[model samples]
Target: MRFVPRPALAAIAALLLLASGCDLLSAEAEVYDSPLSADDRRAPGPSYLQMPVRQQGGAVLHTPSGTRVVRGAYDWWTRDGDLVTAAAGGLLLYGADGQDGRVKDRGLNPDQTGSTGEAISALHYSDRFRIDVFSPDLADRRTIVVPASAFDTDQASGSGAELQLHGDPYTLDGVTWVEWGVNSEDDTLTDHGLFRIEGDQIDGVLRNEPIVRLYPAYDGSALMLLRQDNGEDEDCGGCVVEQDLVELDPETGEVAAEYGMPPGYDRDWRVDAVDKVGDTVAVRFRVYDGEGRDATAQWQLWTYDGEWAEREELAGVRVWFQDGGRLVERPTDPAGSPSTSAGAYPATLTWVPGETGDLSDGEADGEVDGEVLFEPSGATCRLGRGEEFCPQLSTTGSLLPRE
Candidate 1:
């Protein structure tokens, strides 16, 4: 063997290790270059949520370029890949090219605006008796007027009637629908109806049915209405009664089937009707005491297809329906607080697979686990003494996907 200095031998060994590392890296590069089918390749960017700054006015918009602020936005939601924002100035729309497609300033923010990713955006003005509908991209605006006579009733008509929108407008089977109610001068809801809009015209679908909430079945086969069942003409005078989930004919708006609840389901309990996910509809059945305090000792995930079934994997977790037929799941706090509030909490948002048309008898798989999107660090503002205070920022349930 040839004599060699120890230092030289050590230096040579280091060089050999460095060359092997480079070879390993080159091997990895080649493996990555192996042809991946387009279907198998992952999307190019990280998804983001447009969490509303609760105490402040603007929104935090995250694009592939970077995070930017849309100033003066009181609230906002997403449609397609665009933003529908409510600002003190007016409702504004931002497209992918950073174009502001605002259709004239409609005065301060609208009374309300909302949309699911698959549904059209709606700006409701009960005072103005009009609704401005926009396409998913926030383009192609259409204004539909709801006449005062549309809510006319024996006891309510003309000026004495107070028109109120029960909830945000929603779309079912290509038709847009809004819920309207006539409140007595005392502010008591006396009559309510489900109205459908087409072009610039509106028509009633179901009237005065005492429906507390309504959702289109995932398959769009039938409309699900959660209605109160008061006994035999009893004038309980707005007292809470047992509730039933009934299926209604989408076109005729007639009751097609009734899913009865267990007796005393409404004695002192409340139901949070989360929207349909996949082949099932998720609902939160909570209990309260006589004094109207939360008496819910446990949280459970209950879904309804033909009948209600308890889901085991997601028990003790709170689930919210996100746009595009997705469910955002978060572990229930031991103290019994909601994730919708301002605070830092752990959350797991899963996007469930969705199906179209009616699959009334089909089975739905449990949600696949997802990574935690973001932990809300409630309304935060600049702490510096001299700095102009930035708007307090907070995370909201309304999450905007990666832009």
Candidate 2:
């Protein structure tokens, strides 16, 4: 039997179709590259904090390991309402039963009081950051104080270089999305440190930890944990994350296989947070220029090769280098897409603005001098010149999404 590399075969088929010179996609085009204006930029979030939440007034700290309430007058209320107090197994408790009917026990506050429009919102509850629910009132539905914490400092201040945690994800072009971490490692209000817990066993190099780190790789699963890192030094530089492309056995939290992406790409691309199809992951990118004469759009896609060990192995070569490439699409339903066997692959045919080729009549307004192909190394007519996987001479229709 003749064996051919699946990825190589796919790349070749993609080459033939893409090199045919078709119209490009735009942000608003069918291909859909996310449209980003000059105003869309973000900054890195606060490095870390020791404690982001403070206990509210008249509050008392009590651990449930010491309580044993079995029915009778148990602390009970609906998920969408204020907490109610009830005398139970040797203690006074305040909490609510979720819509699923699970009783959530919160410690009691001797002086808890409130007025109109002042209760905690169940929808706003986040396990990642600390929330101090003080003086909650059921009758008034409002409280004296309800402070929530998110790992962001200046909610209104930021530049385009760093990746701030909250607010307007669309404005930040290259920024990846992350969520707060929550688990048994006890990222308590006062305990700030970096540690790892495998199953029930916690171990790893230690370091002073930050207040909060975004870890969206967790999503919803039993392998949930915000792996808080040293955030500054080499070994601990990683942020609080649950998992990257490296899959973990849901029930066991054991090491599974790591998915493949194009090489040289960092975990910063934010792929695990998007939708997936079994082993395949699809991406949504902002295509900037579209097809046809009236074209004014961009579309993008990043597909993950499930069979490979690391995505970085396929990193496209940097012909001089500029910003970077994108991991844009994830395939859904293996049977729905074409075979990854010989003669079939998923790739795009694009018209890159920065790396345009074949400019003979002394360059356009912004076009550079003596450049057939413009890369970070300047202009060139050489075979492998720019960041583009192909050339930019489209004499046909728009480039459609394909295998």
Instruction: Output the number of the TM-score-best candidate.
Output: 1
What lDDT tens digits, residue by residue, belong to model 2 across residues 1-403? 2112356654674576468752111001011111222211111110000110121222221111221222222132211222243333222323322111222343322221111112222212332222223223332222111122322222222322221122111101222122222222222322123222222233321223332322211111111122322333333334423223333232232333333233333333322223232233343222223233433322223445333222221122101111111111211212221122211222222122232222232211222232222121112112234221211110111011111
Give TM per candidate.
0.62, 0.22
- Which tens-of-lDDT digit does each residue in 1-403 have in candidate 1? 2112256654675577587763211111000111111111111122234444354444665433456667655444443345556665666665534556665656546665555444454655545466666665554666677777776455564557667665666665556677887766554446678887665556786677767776543323334577776532555666767666655554545564445553335545556544443334455655443343343333455655545567544454444323333344443243343312223333434433342121221122333544444433333333245322223222222111111
Computed on alpha carbons, the lDDT of every model, listed in order, comes to: 0.48, 0.23
The alpha-carbon lDDT assigned to residue 390 of candidate 2 equals: 15
For residue 306, model 2's alpha carbon misses the true position, in angstroms, by: 2.7
Question: Deviation in angstroms for 332 in model 2?
Answer: 27
Candidate 2, poorest ten consecutive residues by summed lDDT: 43-52
- The candidate 1 region of ten consecutive residues with least summed lDDT is 28-37
